[model samples]
Target: MQLFPKTTTFTLFCAFLTLIHAYDVVREYSGVSFFDEWDFFGSWDNLTLGDVYWLDKSDAFSQGLAYVNSVGNAIIKVDNMHSVQSPQKRNSVRITTKDSYAVGSLWIFDLVHIPYGCSVWPAVWSLGGSTWPEGGEIDIMEAINLMPSNQMALHTTSGCFHNYTPPNQLGATLVTDCSTAAGCTVGELQPNSYGSGFAAMGGGVFATQFDVAGIFTWFWSRPNIPSSVTQSNSTSGIDISQWGPPSASYLAAGQCNITEFFTPQQLILDITLCGNWAGLPEVYFPSCGNRGPTGICYNDNVVGDGSNYNDAYFEIPYVRAYTTGGVAPTPTATPFEIVSKVDISTYPGYGSVTIPLSAVTATNTKLQPSQMFFPGNGASQRISWLQIGVGWWMTSIGVIILIELL
Candidate 1:
């Protein structure tokens, strides 16, 4: 006998399809509450060998290296007041999201300012793994010294390449190989995409969408931001397709398998001085000329009085993460309360402790931390099917299989 009347079976099938179609896209991170969602990178040893020291939570806020401005914006900055002798790194701030995100999501950064100055290397990027190049690094927004425009890049293992270009991309592809050292880089064509020019335009929004199809990045100045993005909040969702042409695009259709090369990425924001990239003579001399008394990146900009770093601070209003298929839980205003610290001393350079999810007391909020990769840890965080927003589709498939057996 049939499992049920034909009409009943048809109704069940339709309900399953409806559930699959009812996925709601929502913001995973909201503006102004960024400090509550992110954590201070406690490592003092600069991984990039930058001429700066990374501050822990207590020191960052106590020293005023990181704090929320009176205007309700988050400010993570370098010490622009104190002078230090040679061989000593300046105090700086580096922070990352407590949660790591896999693909199939869009990340939007709304900013009023970005760190800049000679010897300054600031980036708003994402890292997939702890090991360099293997986990993949997405440079959503990065530039060195007094760069006139922004640079976007993807640093991955061998085999990934940017052979195909998306239509109407505004940036120029500077590199084709998506390998470690020379990551596939794209230079933004807009002069106002970085530095003083960007700040003059009242800063803007930089959006990066990682999907099965490709990785795309777009930039919109304050006055030109799309209504769809500006109006989106934690409860509401954003429509990236309606945002128009992206500034940069890296297609993964044939050239690379994004799923294989990219891991669950954690968002990172930091400003380092005279690092490997910014300190190189080839990079520093061309733009900044011979600077300071010693005519060196570290001696000139990083040493002596920190007068050169007046602009070296990130003033962000909010950063939002959106994913399709699942309804976003409403975020509570409850501040992140650290109940305990996890000693991650085993991880080299990350000898300090961090507030893990289990240490958080807020159980009713969605802003709680997720599985993450501690500093220097090489293991990749696996993304589950539910995290991919395919739970409904999986249920639908199970129903079909059950009906076949019946």
Candidate 2:
């Protein structure tokens, strides 16, 4: 009798700690919802992509350049016909999420396709609230020309750097010191990680987990994503614990303070051509060396010649934000008991289920819910007795005796 009471007290204590550590989905954007969550940013100019065309809020929709497709997917596309003829100018789209994500948040993006072409530079990045480098920038996806893989970069004030050993060697760290001048960069080594190869494989999902430990990113090919992600209709109920090791882990122990370096940031997705990174004579000329006399020139060959831009577009399925230790919505259900036996074997399997304990007064659906045991917590926690009733003392002992027989 004492053993049962002791175990119950211990389990409740563990559950309370677990609940405090878990991340909860606070906001989710998918399909048509994505368009509503983001706004077209047209005030800036891209000197890198040359004197090009950027569609404003009104022009992007009215001109048929950017909008939600028939199936409710967000589409940001470029004009191939106009781009080819006007060598000096090419039309493109840039948009930013309306809300900013704070420190210690996880962002997940499901993409069906990404922009890829000879003169194109497309990116999905996050910017801090402060000016350029002071606030920090996390480039989730950035590619130039026909690059084989994506490049993830961090642009920050002078002090920040990539000090952590990567969990795996999937990407090569191009730079370590994260300064505005060069910025720290890591290039994906996987062949089909970006550009045409990524589109050929049908695009994929990218996740960024930003917390105090450091920033981490993971990518999954279309076919290999977790079932929870593919089947998740809402951000709630999707757990990141099920996902294995991340491809890129940037924890520097105590060397870098992420909170100090990064501020609240807005997400961005855009495509531009033949400027800065891609348009550099050294970068573009080498990629298009085979184009000979007619192929390499900026205005005539790359954009003016109207290089095919049929693939210069992004097809986004969803983008969501989950935060650990964030405010949870008011839970409706009050505490109730629904206990079942937990396995005692060395190989733990505490057959636990989440079922509502009905009551006339309960307004919320979830009722005193808790996991029997979290895997990897420990083996000693898997043994317990069944207890279900109006009060623990009134019916638990009877149910425990009956459960032992059945």
Q: In order, how many clashes per candidate? A: 0, 4
Q: How many steric overlaps does candidate 2 have?
A: 4
Could you tell me every candidate's TM-score relative to the true structure?
0.76, 0.73
Model 2 stretches astray by more than 4 angstroms: 1-21, 47-51, 83-87, 292-297, 300-302, 305-307, 326-406
Candidate with best lDDT? 1
Candidate 1 lDDT, tens digit per residue, 236-343?
655544466677778887887888898778788988887767777766766665676665788778888898899999998888775544322111122222222222
Stretches of candidate 1 off by over 4 Å are 1-32, 326-369, 372-406
> Candidate 2 residues 154-237, lDDT tens each?
777768877555545345666677764446766665556677668878889988877767777767778768886787665464
- Give the lowest summed-lDDT range of ten residues in model 1: 347-356
Q: lDDT of all the models against the reference?
A: 0.70, 0.61
**Candidate with the greatest TM-score versus the true structure:** 1
Task: Count steric clashes of candidate 1.
Answer: 0
